[model samples]
Target chain A: MALITCQNAAFAYEGNTAVSNLNFAVHRGDYLCIVGENGSGKSTLIKGLLGLKVPQSGSVWMGDGLQPNKIGYLPQQTAAQKDFPASAYEVILSGRLGTRGILPFYSRVDKKIAEKNIKRLDIGNLRGRCYRELSGGQQQRVLLARALCAAEKMLLLDEPVAGLDPVVTRELYRLIEKINHETNITVIMVSHDIHSAVKYASHILHLQNTQVFFGKTKDYVQSEVGNRFLGITRRQESGGEAGGGEGSD
Target chain B: MIDILLEMFSYTFLVRAVIVGLLVSLCAALLGVSLVLKRYSMIGDGLSHVGFGTLAVATAMNASPLTVSIPVVVMAAFMLLRISENSKIKGDAAIALISTSSLAIGVVVISITTGMNTDVCNYMFGSILAMSKSDVILSIVLAIVVLILFVIFYNKIFAVTFDETFAQATGVKTGLYNMLIAFLTAITIVLGMRMMGALLISSLIIFPALTSMRVCKKFKSVTICSACVSVLCFFSGVVISYLQATPTGASVVIVNIIAFLLFWTANSIIRRGYA
Candidate 1:
């Protein structure tokens, strides 16, 4: 059975249908990329998948013992977090709170896992560093480690590299690809960088406030909607030298 | 200084005032870190205004002010949270709305019922003599409760404060935790209102956290430092208030200001050394 199955799912925002007509099933070991324009409901769909929002129509089913809280989530950075005072390790350890119920403090196992993920991300040096003081790429890596701690099976990332520079973005994408392929952990990312989305993702779900296309990477690349998106991003890449793929979906 | 301290400690009311002030100060400082991070620092000011309004009404009716004010301030905190969360009004605007109206109501009620007097001054600026035995006992119990809950939920609260969306996605019940912070903050505000007054109570909730953040890089360190700063500042403030015969709230704020400046200087020096 698929890990997550969403059929005819529609989500509304403030009484308006933000995204609708979604149909997809995510299997184990699949890296799915959700692509869209700004306000195209890519984020809304991510939220729905994370169980943060309920569909206004149809349903989102989780199979293979996938619980909503168990999904390791890497959310976009916020302004408040910019000046927040916390060590890198402290932020990562908090991911263990996903399954921690009524436990006042982190367990020894929780600490061990956090330390392991920290080492896995090769951020052992950053363990004592303040989160707010880290560079954008470093912050993303720290956040990724945090997500990995929570995600025993699946990782859900929302715009993990929004403001990162080119080299850092490449490094992050590579790391994510490595995590997905090596560990066989399912990866679902909402991104505006359609080019990187295609390069790293095994499957793509394109949305224009609804499902535009959902299929394998090769099929999506050959599909009309895929070509149109690839053409647009290609133009954007040529148009702007500094940015990766341009704005949100 | 030692002789004066001994003499001050001799008075039963002075002892009560010191004990209650310390507890309230600790509570305010503890809640302040999350409140400041969440940009809900002004919620303290807003709730205090609501508290003043309720306190005025309670006084007019010959009712015990703490009993009357606690529930009302807590409800107002919940209302402010709901308004900001569910409505078009942003958090700051909602706070401004509730705080100003409540302050106005308090002023109007005071003028009509009792007229402008020392009592009004006491409510606005606070007094060392305001800590009655019953109020001290209640404050101690409530402060202990706040401290216990805060410690027990420390991890969950950290998760919520750091990232609400991630915490929610992880099934942390972010709403309930936010409400818990608001609830605890309201109680602390009500408990401190009598001695810190309406205008200066929020300083106790904002200064220590900010001062600690200047010198501490880790959340645990910042929290521990903030609590220490709050207790020290409150103790010194009370001493200065007693020695100088000044308003308790203003004195506490002044002490906090001094501590903040000292920490700011130390942090800059530390950074300079690193550079």
Candidate 2:
């Protein structure tokens, strides 16, 4: 069964329609990459998926018999977030909040799981440090750890590595790969990095405002529709394009 | 001074006022961190103005301020939340609109009711000297409710405050928590009226959080430090008011400013030395 389904979904902010006739299905253990230009309704779709913005028409259905706590998310980071006064540990611990309900305290088991995840990220030493004091990459890692705290089966990352050096970007992708491969968790990440998507994702979703293309990564590379949607000249040699093409780096 | 202190101890109302002030200090510090972090530092200011209007209207109607103000401010809170969610009016602007309008209505209502003869100095500027027994009890109860909510929703609140979209993606119900924060803020504003008053209440909700950020590098430490600063400042303000016969709200705000300046100066010096 599909873990998340958006069927004929439509969303509007006031009178302006942001998304219309959107349809998608996300199964477990699939690494799907959503690629789009800015204001292509990508964030709006994600918001709908997360149940933040209710659809004006159609429905979004998370699979039945699954706990709500199984979903995890990493939002786009802003410069202002650096000055927020939360510790990395505390931020990560918040992931457990969904599963713990609205209770007054964290259980010992919850603490243990959170600690284990923190140590796994190898940022145990920095756990007690303020989230704001850390470098951007470190803060992102801490946020990733926090996302993992509650996310058991699926992870949704929204432009996780939007602004970073090449080395840090690769390292961050590696961490995400490890989580996906080792845990067999379904991963849906939105990125402008076509190269990285080619490297990591099995499935591709290209969105341009009302336009959308969904298929296997290889299929997207070969198909006429995919080529037009992606606005890329396909290379037959590697079934993917050449090095560091526009916005991919 | 000893005689005044003794006199204060003798009155149950005074004792209750002190206790209520202490409790509210903790609440202010706790919520202050997130408010400042969100950069919506004017929430307290906006909401308090709404509370002031509600109080004035209630007084004009010859109704109980506490009872009337709660629903009025709570409704205003919902309106603020709805307007902000529209993505048309910016958050600060929406807050400003509601704040100024309600205050204007309040001023008009008060003028009409009392023919502009009644003294509302205590409500405008804050006077711990005038706190009644019922006011003290109400503040205490409200403070406790705010504290309990914080303890329960600490994680969720932190996530939403830090990055709202991320919290929603994680299945954390960001909208619900957002409404919860606004609701609690309304209650805090109404309860804050007696001690902090309309003019200076925002300072109590903002300064402690900023001071904590200056000295503490960690989130947990910031929260702890903010709470301590709030409690300490409340009593010191009370004492200063006693000694100088100044307004209690102004005294507390002065204390907060001193702490903020001191902490900022010390932080800059330390950073400079290291550099």
Candidate 3:
């Protein structure tokens, strides 16, 4: 069963339509990478799917016992948010805020999940440390752990490796792949890194100026839209080594 | 110095001033962490100016200032938030525009209604005698309410202040909590204006939070330390005002300045030690 479905949806900001006529379904255990240009509304689509923004047209449906609150989100980091005064433990623990039943306090189970994620992310030693003082890779690890605590079934990440070094970025991608593969958690990631996206994602949603193509990774590589968007010829596509070719002109 | 302090506390008005000042300080500091973190600290200054304008009108109409000023200032706080959110005014600019205009209106009202009197001086630069017995009681009650509400919602506030978008995405009702913070800050600013004056009350809201952030990295620790620092500074400022015959509001702000410097120095030394 599909965990999430967006049917003929359109996302807008301040009456300006960003992306429209979007239709996609995310099944359980699918690693979906949403790749698009700078203003192609990838983040807006993610926001619409997460219920942060209402779709201007059509609808987004969460099924198979999935709800909006159960989805974890790791937003793109901003400089101001980076300076937030919080401990790594505190940041991770806040991921359970959605499940705490309006009591405004963390429960024992929440603490356990937070600790488990901390250990899973190998950030146990950084738990008590201040978030602002951590290195970029460590901070991203803490945030990823927080997102894990937020959703055990699904995770949505926006540019999670945007500013990290190549090594750290590769490590994060591996970690996310492990979570998706081992835990059967649905992963929908918005990324500018086309190389990593094609390498790891099971499914690819390529959004262009006025079009969106969603299909299996192999099929996407073979499709005309994919060939043009990924800048791969049919002969080179078979190799599966077309190193992160540029998107459509 | 001890004898003089004791004698100053012997006066009923001084006792009332101390009680109200300490309570207001505690509440201001408690909420200041979120305000500073959210970059809404200047809202205190804006609301205090609105309070001053309302107080001026109340005095002109021969009505109770607290009753008149509280609701008007609260409304202004909400308006400022709305304007900053929806309009092109933005945060700091909105604050500057609202505060300066309200301050001008207050000056005009005071001058036209009562001429150049001690009341104008008291409102601009606070006097210890500004707190009456009833005002003290009211301030204590409101301050306790603010403190209790803040403690109950501490975790939620922490989430909102850290990342408002994420908080809202997680179903935390970020709008309601933002309104709650604005409302509580309005009440604190109104209650504190008579003691700290319109111009200086914002310092009470900004200083303790900034000072505490120097030493504490966690929200809980910063909040706890801010409350401690606020109360200690208020007490010390009030005592110094009494003994040295200084303006109460100015004296308190000076104390905060000294405390901020001390904390900054200590934070630097500690960071160096760790390095």
Supply every candidate's count of residue pairs whose N, Cα or C atoms clash at under 3 angstroms.
Answer: 2, 0, 0
Q: Which scores better on lDDT, 1 or 3? A: 1
Q: Which stretches of candidate 3 lie over 4 Å from their true place?
A: A209-211, A232-249
- Worst lDDT window (10 residues) for model 1 chain B? B82-91
lDDT (0-100) at residue A97 of candidate 2? 73
| Per-candidate interface DockQ score | 0.88, 0.52, 0.64
Q: After superposition, how far is residue A117 of candidate 2 from its true place, in Å?
A: 2.5
Candidate with best lDDT: 1
The deviation in Å at residue A94 for candidate 2 is: 0.7
Worst 10 residues of 2 chain B by lDDT: B115-124
Residues B1-275 of candidate 1: C-alpha lDDT, one tens digit per residue = 99999999999988998899999999999999999998888888899989989988999888999999999999999988787676576778878988999889888988899998999889988877888888988999999999999999999999999999899899898899999999999999999988899988999999999999999999999999999999999999999999998888899999999999999999999999999
The local distance difference test score of model 2 is 0.78
- Which digits, one per residue and each the tens of the lDDT, describe model 3 over residues B68-113? 9999998998988787566555778878998999889988998999
Summarize candidate 3's per-residue lDDT along A24-143 as a digit string, tens digits. 899999999998877888878877877889989888888899888788888877666677778989999998888876796788999999999988888889999999999888988888
Error of 2 at B256 (Å): 0.8
Clashing pairs in 3: none
A127-155: candidate 1 lDDT, tens digit per residue: 99999999999999999999999988999
